[model samples]
Target: MKFSTYFNDWLYGQDGYYTKYRTIGKGGDFYTAVSTSKFFGGSIGNKAISTIQSGFLPSDTTIVEVGAHHGYLLADMIEFIYTLQPQLLDTLTFAIVERFPHLQEQQKKYFKESFGDAVKLIHYNNISEIKLDSAFIVANEIFDAFEAELVYTTQEGIRKNVVVTNHQLGFEPCDDLFLNAICDKYGIRQGEIALGYETFAQNLAQNIKKFEFITFDYGEKYPRNDFSTRIYYKHKVFPLFQEELNLNELFGKSDITYDVNFMHLIDSFNQAKIKNVSYQTQLKALVEFGIITLLEILKEKAGESAYLREVQKVKTLLEPTGMGDRFKVAIFRKESHA
Candidate 1:
């Protein structure tokens, strides 16, 4: 089977990791910015308000989150937005784009418990289902979750893709025109390339007449020469290609992920008529979104002990050698083509 097929099943199949067993935070396979601090979501809430006030988005625009795990990020954003601008809640609608029924139930339960009857949440099974005139879309660590294809160039300049055969992963030449063209266009000889970004972008372009899109994920703008795919099992990192590693034993049990190639990602959206507004490190983006100001407000309202505890957690989101520098924030905008 092709690696993308194998990968998609392992992470998203009916009984896949995300479908039944995926967990996030310190106890799970990994920690996301959402798990680090509510301030992460709070910062984004600030940006949302600014966008609406600056006339970039309408007041009634839906705040949509794609691949919202447990709906924590969106919930936190709503909480912070309520704290900052409760009046805006009267106009804005909230929604989550989640594919799996089980995950959707989980998100619904979380939202209900978090806000009770105060907020009305909409659910969609796919991006293509969103039929909004305008939207403010946010996706955190979502691109890395998309199925990816690994490809490399041969000595004769032939392109080959990685696949799973006989329970072992190996590389072979294939007839994937899209991957071939993308590799050639970007001068990418070898790396794990995310699939479906163009389709995802195009779906948003077609479904939502006007939109502002923001996503946070770990990656570089340029393609990496070396493979970045790895496995996370109980917070322990395992190199995907390590010899003696049993691929079958880890199937559907471990989280498999790779760094994104943002250049390819931005270009994909660009081709779909969604233009990128900015791409920057998580540190810069969070600071600009007023994470520090939110922290100060918490310190004053929540007391010193609570403030100290939260600050330490927030540091992980802004740590120089860690999430701060490793993760990136990409923002894109699309106005009515008509």
Candidate 2:
């Protein structure tokens, strides 16, 4: 089987890692920006409100989140938006695109516990199910989750794909024309190649006539020369192809992810007529969203000890060598309705 098939089954199939794992916080397999701080969502909320108020998006635009693991980010975004402009809540509808019924239920339960009847949330099984004239879609670490093919170049400049057989991983000459074409186009000789981005973008464009899509994930604009796939287990990182690591033992028991190729992502959305509005590091995005100002306000209002604790957590988000630089934010929009 191709590595992409193996990856999809291991991470998203029945009894897969995401299907079985319930924890995603400080104690979980890994930490996302959501788990790192509420302000991550708060910043997004601020941006959304400004976009709506500026006439860029409609007043009743549906706020949709794709791949909302446990709904923490969306919840926090709603909370901040409510605080910033409570009246906006009356016209906005919140929705999440979640494929798993169990995860959908978890999201609903969390929302109910957080807002009761104050906020009504809608759930969709996939992007194609979303229907709206105007929408503000947000996703964190989503593109990286799409199944990617592992490709490498041989000494003779021949491209080959990784395969799994008899519970062992090996490589064979690349036979897929599409995979070869993608690598050739991107000048990628050795790296993971994600498929289905074009279909995903097309689905969004077909269902939602007009929308702004923003996502945060780790990757660079240029193709990497080496593989960026890894497994996360118990907060420890394991390179997927590590010699000592047994792929069979970790199946359905750990988180698997890869760095996204932003260049390819942008091109796919562009083909769907969605314009790339901006691309920047997470650090810059947060600063533009006024996270530092929020902290200052907290310092003035909250006790010194409480403020200090939050500052420490927020540092994890802003540290130049950490998530701050590793993560990139990409924003796209289709303003036909405007």
Candidate 3:
């Protein structure tokens, strides 16, 4: 069976696809930036504070977080907000949007134990239903999850819907309208394969209004050959993996993600008429706003080693060749509704 077909069957059926993913943790398939260190949350929290202060009335602001895995960052933001501006804490409401049921339950458990009823948890299967008048939206590593159409260009013309159907999965060309539209928009010529992160990013930008968007992900601009139709399973990167296979079985129940093009995101933001967009690494943004200063304050509450580790993690986020450079942070702001 084709990899995509197998994946659809396993994920849709009562098989162990979702069950296996529910158990992903510290020793699971891979560790996210959040799991790697607390500094990631601390640095992001610092950015969130600056964002909130710049546009909204803290007393009536709603901070919405998409793909809020484990709720650690949300907790960190709450603490940071309290420390910086105590008055905003009482009026603040946090809405965590999580898709996975098991993870949502875990988040609830953590929030209930630590924050009581202060935080509001919302389960969303799609982004279309999220309604907001004036809010600050944050999505970390969320765009990469959008299912993308794959196209391969040849001397003859652009081929669409490339699928693998051999003993081992590979690419076979098909005629898909959506894929063709992407090719037309991007001017991807014959003899080149292109993925559809630009289309997905543009759609997301058009959907939401009346808020500042801060997205963290990894990708590059156009004319970049680094992004291929590939899959990462169990920390192993594979170029020929298709969507029809049992992802959990073939990849050891890991999370499959794609690289996001930051330039495409900037273009989308401009198309949406969301003026005032800033792009930087997570570490640079944190340091500019004094994340080290926050660490010093945390050292008094926690131990020195814990504080230092957090600072180091933030520093790692700044390394140009490391996550700091690989991962790009884009911030978009609209005029405040209030």
Tens-place lDDT digits, model 1, residues 125-228:
99988999999999998899899999988889888899998669888885888888888888889898889999999999999999899999999999987789
Q: What is the C-alpha lDDT of each candidate?
A: 0.91, 0.91, 0.60
Candidate 2 steric clashes: 0
Q: How accurate is candidate 1 locally (lDDT)?
A: 0.91
| CA RMSD per model (angstroms) | 1.2, 1.3, 4.3
lDDT: worst 10-residue window of model 1? 14-23
Candidate 2's residue-wise lDDT over 245-276, tens digit each? 88888888989999999999999999998999
Better of 1 and 3 by lDDT: 1
Please give the range of 10 consecutive residues that has the lowest summed lDDT in model 2. Answer: 18-27
Q: CA shift at 201, candidate 2, in angstroms? A: 0.7
Deviation from native of the Cα of residue 34 in model 1, angstroms: 0.9
Q: 247-331 in candidate 3: lDDT tens per residue?
A: 3355424455556656555666676566546787665665665667777888888889988777776566667866767777778
Give residue 69's lDDT in candidate 1 (0 to 100). Answer: 81
Show pairs that collide, candidate 2. none
Order by TM-score, highest first: 2, 1, 3
